[model samples]
Target chain A: MQEELIRKHRWFWAWADDREEAWLREMAQQGLHLGKAAPLGEYFFVRGEPRDDVYRLDYVPMSKKDEHYYQLFKDAGWEHVGEMMGWQYWRKLATDSQADEIFTDNDSKIQKYQRLLAILTIFLPVLIINVTNMGVFSLREKYPWIIGLQVFSIFLLVFYSVVLLRILFRIRMLRRR
Target chain B: MAGSDVRKYLPLTESTYYILVALSEPMHGYGVMQKVEKLSEGTVTIGPGTLYGAFGTLEKAGLIRMVKEEERRKSYLLTARGRAVLKEQITRLAIMNRNGQGLLGILD
Candidate 1:
């Protein structure tokens, strides 16, 4: 048997973690298993025989320093595959009886999205400050590089705002359920 | 805590109630999950994500505390405040159950 490593590209916003999980499960069904996930939307996969596996992602920001956190998941029968940018990747065999859901209730599911929203909230103000500085201080005229930085900050601000809104909507939807 | 204050946390959700009951004795995260499942007869299952998030919230609310760590797993048990809240919730649930059963008998 030989190991085949492939890099796959996928963009997943914080609120769309379920989409990323679905994509990973689809890859597993096609005999490509995720090995390592890197920063900036790159996923490394190893080729293997097709199998039914359930992939789940949990936004655990401080889990890198929390051994007990990972151990709990491990003891619950989830295999810790890897961590990329505060997201923990876990997989378990697709079984016949129980459904594969990391959150059993709506309250906990809302909490997960709230955590993601919190992260976006933190960066939002910083991006706003950058945009304001460029506009008010006239830095774009003094420094040519400031123009590029301003444009990048504006893009990030829009992206973060969209993600934040989606997460808030998810929390509201969970509460209604 | 006063009875009224403890009442604020009453009507614990199914998952939270099972978790608090399981933590009546010292147990870690995974232990709580297993005990809850057994106590509910497989009717309720707390997944890792829910369990982890609940631990943080309950601990912050002074309802639970970490007792010790064995091999990377941390054991937790209810605090005095937790017991007070749980007791209040049980009282509320008992009243609700009695009313429901009485209404059911009338319907029958």
Candidate 2:
């Protein structure tokens, strides 16, 4: 599954699975229009005209009231300005206070930290295993101690991956909230 | 509680004020959006995401509640608290307007 996703896109949004794809399809069905096709989570960003600003709405769906707010903003002369995956929206503020609201309380930084952990979880174990494999080949005998350490490291890595996956799921749920 | 009044609740955002004003009618999400835009003279365009975020907050605050739902769409109405807030805002605006006009000698 991962291989297929990597083939289609240079980067995977996170992971690929049939269920994930189905849910993404449902999100698209709700109100989103994808500019380009890739994989379940992989999205291609595109820039459009000044009138119709392009945005790739991720799995996150905007609420009904926020939709009203955006319309009000658009009515107030805030044109389609820019787009980002689910986070960025073109807004023109009537008041300085309104503009202040945009910069405050962004969770993206924390999300990025979590993503860093995910990358470590994915790569760290692989590194340990490759190093152990090389050592075993050079030694010409699988030392019992080294074998036990390698097995333990692999198990730890698998456990770390599961925990990272859980954290990612929690973040997704928070986005829904 | 249902009639015209201006007190008890206060400190409403412009978006919330407009939303409550629009919800005075039986308007759905798109309907409320349209009315707000029309009333504001096309000065505000609330995206769908932001609308839902506000709805979640307002509904949780007991200022608004979901009145109807159809398929994936929903309509919300102001609660008594929401109406009170709107009334208070109106009274405050009125007072400020009167004082400013008197001070500026703009009233006839």
Candidate 3:
């Protein structure tokens, strides 16, 4: 029997949304269409006829009136496939007359990154507090395991910094053009 | 609109200008998007993301208000302040257009 569904695992950072969109489009062309998305980089696909559909990802904070948001997109010809952690996955059949974008103006496009940046920065205070209270430098002599914990903390801090910088860079690039 | 208020929204961007003009009648976000395209003669297209965000901003600024809600769709109309702002914008555009009327040959 042919498999009707397949699960693919992939990870994409917040700044690499375009790369993720391209990958989804490629999967569609290969007779696999995204049917569901799960957290921690899990995507389930359904086998289907080959298509040249375009996929777009938009990030929006959870709102009280999300139904209106969905309806607007539906009317605008975008099919809201799935949403994960405020990231909306939209798909539409490719048409020659229309551009593959859900944001027509630069300000709204920049606002998308600004929203992502806000979510990422909310962790800044918590990260700072955890590092300061750890006092791992002085405790390293008393407990060797604290060194490993401290290293992990530094690694997380570095990862957060890079993500923040990339999002800011994207905003600046959008503003310049 | 007051002098200060008019100045704040005078130089509307292309999308914002078209959106405000479209809100002259009560219409939902998608309706506004379609009307904008038609009014601009296919020159401008407002994607759903942009239109959704604009609705929030315009509503917050008191330039547009929800007049009715049908199912999940909310229709909005221009507030008095929004109409005033649009008027000011059109006047500004007319002046600018007149100033550049006979200067096309200056461009390379």
Candidate 4:
């Protein structure tokens, strides 16, 4: 028999990972364990007995998914929940002997943010180049919709810059600790 | 690699320290985690994330290299540089231990 799954929609910012973890843990406490997260901001959960579970969101650095990476985490007992937008969701039932946290030291945590920064640095430039290559300025005279595309591209450039800055600030704060 | 190169990784993190020590024999990620816990007598625990990240950084620095891969698990062994780095760390730790022997003396 198929277990009925519950779906929920919510959004989280890159800097608000702790908030995301809290919200997911709360969902687990209410017996709605995460089954999969897909299509962005949509969380599918499997209804089960209410229990304490810890959720962690990890950003894998490489563009390609490494099975070895998952296997290592499995070795340490973190069950892979689902991934959305390159952030891996890991769940571990709360236990006295097992560790609740995923990354142990500040250096590893800093490296996580560093990996995110690397992705942004790679994509942000590609996006700008692609937008410019679209000839938005020249095409706008013939195609008015090109102006809207230009505006959206500019907005994304700014959004990417802001997110980059926020992550840099977060890394600095972690170093201070 | 002793004068400055080895000292660059001096004062290794507890996890890194235990990891290098454990990799005296090639071991996989899960093996390293279990060995670290035992070596530290349950005091220092290396979660998978830290260990995996350390493997990347260490491998990149030529301090550790993957010697075997099987069943989706890669086993790593310390390089000559890794051994030098570990020795430098031990020297510093030994000095600290000697200078702070009062605690051990008092306890004994």
Candidate 5:
């Protein structure tokens, strides 16, 4: 029964399988290189008792291809299961009520806070510079060195902002790791 | 460790050594961790981050490559260069063992 199932499955291509071997030979005979974009074969996952069976047919398209076999599966009435990164799996849900639950981690408060801080770091110094310059104009009436001091403050703020941004960017990259 | 002993592994870090040792077979990250722990008798414990970092470095250096990847796991295999490095490390360890035992002069 297992041998018959494997023989019937389209994904179970073997060198000894005359049909697949002939197909490969025909393609080669056409002077077309069997590039990495062809379907390698397919397989199914069936476990547990015969009465209560679960079937998951898996297909590997070429060495690193998927679109072709995916269309093939779709045409055969197989439902698409969620992919694991680039590796995809398809399953026909046994019943209407049965659904596979895939886990995904949502962004936490700490991550959100870090992102917010990163954005704030970008504009914080510009806001500081604007406020300090405004103060310089307003206080110039009473203080003679107000403009000079404000210019120095602007430079300091710019330097601080650059340093802060660098540090924040580094932290963000580290957090991503 | 002595300077000469440390200098033998110019590129491979301690973690890389542990990883290569673990990959003597095609083992996944968690399996590698378990093997390293067992081999060291619980002296070294590599966290996921550190182990991945070392793995990335070893892979980039062409000392290891992915053998297989299953659900939530990836197994690695050592390259020819990796095997050579492992051999050299073992030889160094053998020398160190002999030297220490010779110094002790204790009868087995």
Candidate 6:
């Protein structure tokens, strides 16, 4: 039989990885399994018989270059589905015990979100430079389109800042537990 | 030895304690996971993320070191410092258990 493939345009924020995992697991339950994931929320899934599969995403920026990283997960009964950016996609058979969580402890879960926050921090300076150097007021008359673009960029900068703060709060909350 | 230096890492978290105990003999990440589960009688199951992060933290703290690599699977063993920390944690737990057990008689 030929392979049936489907593409989905769903976007998830940095803090919504758990939601993404749940959505992928839900898709698997409906006989659609995630295949290749592209940037900008593009996901390719292959049609297959519905099965109980638990999907997990781990944010490990440095592990992409390490062979042992993938091997470790593979040895632990998780299949390396694919990677979107630095997030590693893994799937395992859902057992009756529901013990397939990628992070078993609050500290490790906090570390995962910290890694994400670190990445976003790296981009913050570049966005700030663009917003300041571009000078929306100066470009408002000569280059009106540039002003609109600047406003959109500022919006994105604010959005990311809020996300970064939320992740920080989450880490703090985890640490308090 | 730096007893005070290693004491901070003492009272190892349940996952870290199990991981350290499992690495008493050299073992890889997956091996550690399986051994921990077996040793804990399925009460403690360390996931990949927790295991990986634990390995890195332990290695950095000079408690564990990579002993060898087999087919890209890095095997780790507890260092002398690691063994000391584990012993200290076990001692603490033993004391706690004795006290708790004594109280159980009174409560009953």
- The residue-by-residue lDDT of candidate 3 on A99-177, one tens digit each, is 5679889999899898888888999888877776676563747565676677778788888888899999989999999
* Candidate 3 backbone collisions, by pair: none
RMSD of 5: 20.3
Off by over 4 Å in 6: A62-64, A136-142
Worst 10 residues of 2 chain A by lDDT: A1-10
lDDT ranking, best first:
3, 4, 6, 1, 2, 5
True contacts kept of each: 0.86, 0.00, 0.88, 0.84, 0.00, 0.81
A79-139 per-residue lDDT for model 2 (tens digits) = 4433334333332323434231221122432343354454456676676777677566647
In order of appearance, the predictions have TM-scores of 0.91, 0.45, 0.93, 0.89, 0.39, 0.94
In model 4, residue pairs whose N, Cα or C atoms come closer than 3 Å (at least 3 residues apart or on different chains), thus clashing, are none
Clashes of each: 0, 35, 0, 0, 3, 0
Task: Pick out the ten consecutive residues of candidate 4 chain A with the lowest summed lDDT.
Answer: A133-142
The reply for model 4, stretches above 4 Å from the true place, is: A61-64, A96-98, A127-146, B103-108
**How would you encode candidate 4's per-residue C-alpha lDDT over B1-108 as one tens digit per residue?**
367988877778888899999999999999999898898998988888888899999999999999999999999999999999998888889889988886886876
Model 5 ranges with Cα > 4 A deviation: A1-177, B1-12, B105-108
Preferred candidate (TM-score higher): 3 or 4: 3
DockQ for all models, in order?
A: 0.75, 0.08, 0.81, 0.73, 0.01, 0.78
User: What does candidate 4's lDDT look like per residue over A1-177, in tens digits?
Assistant: 899889999988787788999999999999999999986689999999997999999998556479899999998888998888789999998874548878889999999898888887988878788678666564747676776777787788888889999999999999999
Q: Assign candidate 1 its CAPRI class.
A: medium
Residues A38-74, model 6: lDDT tens digits = 8899999999899889999998786335888788888
The list of candidate 1 runs beyond 4 A from truth reads A96-99, A137-149, B105-108
* Tens digits of lDDT, candidate 2, B1-108: 334433433556566678788887665666766687688776664544445556666788787888876655667888887777777788888888888977786545
The worst-scoring run of ten residues by lDDT in candidate 1 chain A lies at A135-144
lDDT, candidate 5, residue A162? 69
| lDDT agreement with native, every candidate | 0.86, 0.52, 0.88, 0.88, 0.51, 0.87
Q: Model 6 Cα displacement at B47 (Å)? A: 0.7
For the predicted complex of model 2, DockQ is 0.08
Residue A149 lDDT in model 5? 67
Q: What local lDDT does model 1 show for residue A39?
A: 89
